[model samples]
Target: MPSTSIESAAVDGRARTPRFIQRQLANLHKAITTNAKIIQDAIVADTGAKLREAQLEIHLSISVVKELYDNFSVEEALSQEYRVARGQDWCDRNDAVGTIYLRPQSHNLVYSIVSPLANAIAAGNCVVIESNKPHQALSSKIAEIILQHLDRDTIAFVENLPEPPSKGVLLIDQTGEIPKINASSVHTPGSSARVVALVDRSSDIVSAASSIVQARTAFGGNSVYAPDIVLVNEFAMKEFVQAAKIALSISIEETKGQDITASQATCKIAGIGLTEKELRGSGANVVMRGDLGTIAIVEDRGSSLLQRKIYGACLILHSVRSLDDGIDLANLQYGTVAPRNKTLLACYHFGAPEAAKYTTQFIDSYASFVNHAPIELTVGPAAPIGFHPSATHRYRPAMFSVPKADCIAGDSASRSLASIFRAEAKAWSDVYEKQITSSLAPTRQKAGKVVGFFDQGLITGFVVFWVPVIASAVVGSGYGIRAGIRMTRS
Candidate 1:
């Protein structure tokens, strides 16, 4: 039934006015507020996130909904006046290109969906949030809860949202990923999470190690944004490891996000004094053969770890020569199109402001943090870092629609960029009008008779005399005032 309604919406691809979209979103918001506890518990039950973390996600979701509901306007979406453009001179006008199909993520599912969902709603287009295997139950539950309140024709809820339709697939990239801007792929960003904590030699060892452990244990290391590896200076590898072990309060067996269903791999190589080659070599014993959910403080020995993605509640410790070297290694490992090819956020920690500034120039991600890691579930107390990159940058509401340039000013003469330019243009225009009028004062534009003054270039001659004359008079008067002041002083 939902599919049929939604398919009908697709025919026109213009189901919503801005006010209607906001009103529908407000209904969803009211439903969410009324069923807040159900949603929170659903997230916890579905994703294994702790209660507090689940609460934060729900709060963020509600915030986004309210923000979109209040901020979105139908008239504003279609057209806006450009203040400087006088009238009919210049402005920006937005046109909804087509429909947007939103896809939820595999893990941290609720937090993931809130961001893109809010944006799609704000973009004021036909929005459909369809579910996949991981999101089947939750999506069905949400569809059941929220669908009744939403406009079925304008916005649809597909309990099992299918693969994106071939029509109006907004993205085409050589990167092989179908562009999250269109539909999220089966391999979500969580699969290739690469968060490295760059600890410089000058950093306080205990503070650095404790904070690193605190971040990984945040939401029990379930977030894709959590630290997977700690790359510290080789100068402090020993002291750092001891402090980190104290801070890591849980055993490797207790790691939350590990798939008990999948086989665990670890190795003797995740030990002291293993060489770089030994760690990366094909020898089975030297490889990390089992899941090291516990902290493993190995030397900066090369491991398939950097070359691969680790989603478990795991932290691999490695040493680097300098903070700059750590940045280089992170970029090599986590930068887009790099070996791992998926990193949404990266962080750099330095002791001094200068050091932090110097190191930041090379770091890359959809978002980057200095002095602090991007570790929080949401921007509140437990994890103090306050950036929501996905909602803010990666999938901004701006992406869903395109703003076009328009002219609203009177005519070409009134379209000047500056006040002076407008005045000059108006003055010249008036003079041209005056000249034509004066020439026609004695004789009118007679039938089949060319205006003799126009043919004699009277208007052009007037323009030539008056334009520079007005300009020079203004310039000369300004200069004359300045010269008079100087002479009086003399």
Candidate 2:
């Protein structure tokens, strides 16, 4: 059996090469555009993803690449402007210090992985990648296209997520691996990198129910991202169930076309809510509605909310009595959210300003507001953009303490440390350490005997060399006395 260490192969001298890095990214951009026709044709041809979804990914990847390039270029211009405006203080963007690993969802390579990889490589990282699925003719074709442009070794694409050949975890002996993205394996980004996980909670209960109906009648409800669990606030359970029933009722009639099992084994964990119909279709037990929110999320109790990365539209609602509860939930579940992931946290009487502040604070992974402005702007919050990495969560970016280790704009350390330090310095002052302090005083005399010293109540001793005790005793305290005695005797 052969074993492969992907990062080891790509990393050289603890980092990646820049010249080749830029070239690969530039080529990737061209490849994505060049292969757009093939990508769309292949996805549609293969029936893996919806054509529009595939196309959207292509567009998004291109847009992101362009955005990253533009951002870097603008930063350069800004530096020049600053130099011109105020002599030589301006600074321009330079090559970054470490590698960025882009781990994308399986089956959707073009949008999720490739585009992000291009951006990461452009930022100057030697990249190593793994494909989510293996033996797909479409993936093979795309990989060939990508390989033509970039160095094969610089960008590795594992056929699928399997243990290293030597790890002894045989594929046949175990429960099969799911076709999903693994966030932990990507390089840590030089001890100062940020890692974000994206998830979309069950966004459409109506659609989920309808899909279940369709699947039961047409196919099966064994699809990824299907609403596996329904977490509603115990208070809102009735309202949520009513809303879901209404939504499903509308969907059922609209299609007049499907049979959804709303009862089977709706595994209702203590706090998780689900019915027999929902559980019949769920891969795991659903969390029931309870008197919990962000705070509950943080305290992983037996009957609390779930915090693992959830994709697809498995709706998990956490009921909260107050805004503070919601934010506490966000902090607890910070590990679960990512950019572009969507889910709803409801509050009945909250206003937008308070909504915005709280949502911004709750921001994790990618924070978004679906139906209404995050907090229900009608009575919720007005700020559209939800939570961002911040102090309450202890998220900050790297400070780039040294010139050589220039930090990326949104790296992990920056989000957890630098960001927190700058935003909540007063609150976190006691924990901050000063870089320099006065030296300690020596505690030994020239006589070689140990001398003692006191410093702020700390006593310390050290030994030092001196003349013999007999000689010192004879000569010490007698120089003047002996001289006087000699004079009197004369």
Candidate 3:
């Protein structure tokens, strides 16, 4: 990887117009869809992932290119480019950040590379993808496809980082480790962080179990979004465990007899039953294990499984006393004096909306899901650190761009501090006195229904009590009037 190549790519990226970028993305999309089968086969060959999983990765990869192409507008881009010349303020304007260095993860190699590559190109950036795994079938195939369709000057696949790394380069590192290079980077530190699923008693046990099992076993359980451990409410433990066993059994049976290469041997699960003494000594008890995955129960918080990341299809189940207990367990990091907040990669809260909201509020994670673990998350690289996770794509176009606002109009609401400073001492005193004497306006109430459980119960009681009584009184009065009329007639 020559330093000059990246430099040339960066220069070319800056010169690329929105139309040119859009055309390139369109070509890439066409190329991917045309060669979808080859890509899918390569994915399966490299990762030993199921054919369906490979198909999904290919589909998602094509979607990335399509999404970028569809969302990009040549008219809006040109307008922003010449906003200042047209004497208009371009608020919230962003320009491409030149070259993007992508280090993709290996779980879903096709999706990992395609997502950032497409986003960077759509944002008018040149890309330098680090495809060091040339021996990998998926990597080589991706390089072949990308190079054939994309502009050569604007895109280069290098096995190593460019020597004497350039400044102002945006590094998208999905390899988990924070890049040691001296450049602006959007690295997902949480890729290596623990992802925990909290299953409250209020949650649907069957749904939670199904989701947990699928997420844990999908794509050989290499997804970073897969829950490293599950914190089931103590009250729901029995039912949850039962449901999880059924789900895991079904998943294992589905993937039975699939080819397991030497690389995938680690993902295989063998059934084992540990005694009470063994469970306490080991801090984990394997309840269910099969060809596809394993399910273990970890009652001890100090268990090493709770402290570290689980890369295979092993689901660690722990009983939590309450929502607070789940939160506490989710924040478990070994060797920390006090539990750190917001250290989790992602939190999956399986409960009622109220319980999920409470869990999310107290637990700090990069991403939080209420009920389901998204299958999309099991494919692409984790969202860049400090940015909100997108439900559709891994990296947004804006992440590859730098803020470049053009201001042509003055702000009317901005007060002049100079005017206040220039005021005379007596004027300042008068202004201070006026401010001190002025009554503060009351805070406006928040909009929408603010009713709580007690309030709702009271309203229900009022309606239930008054409606029947009122109806009875009206009926009795009508009956008496009818009888009086009959007596008068007689």
Best of the candidates, lDDT: 3
Against the true structure, what is each candidate's TM-score? Answer: 0.64, 0.43, 0.82
Which runs of model 1 end up more than 4 angstroms from their true locations?
1-4, 7-15, 73-90, 159-176, 179-193, 204-207, 250-293, 336-345, 375-394, 410-490
* Candidate 3 residue pairs in backbone clash: none
lDDT of 3 by residue, 32-127 (tens): 998988887777766667888889888888888887888889898887788789888898888888888888876688888888888888887888
lDDT per residue (tens digit) for residues 270-289 in model 2: 12233434433433334332
- Which predicted model would earn the best TM-score? 3
How many steric clashes does model 2 contain?
A: 53
- Model 2 C-alpha lDDT versus the unseen true structure: 0.38
Best-to-worst TM-score order: 3, 1, 2
lDDT of candidate 1 at residue 357, scale 0 to 100: 69
**Where is model 2 more than 4 Å wrong at Cα?**
1-26, 44-47, 72-104, 134-138, 151-351, 355-490
What's the lDDT for candidate 3?
0.79
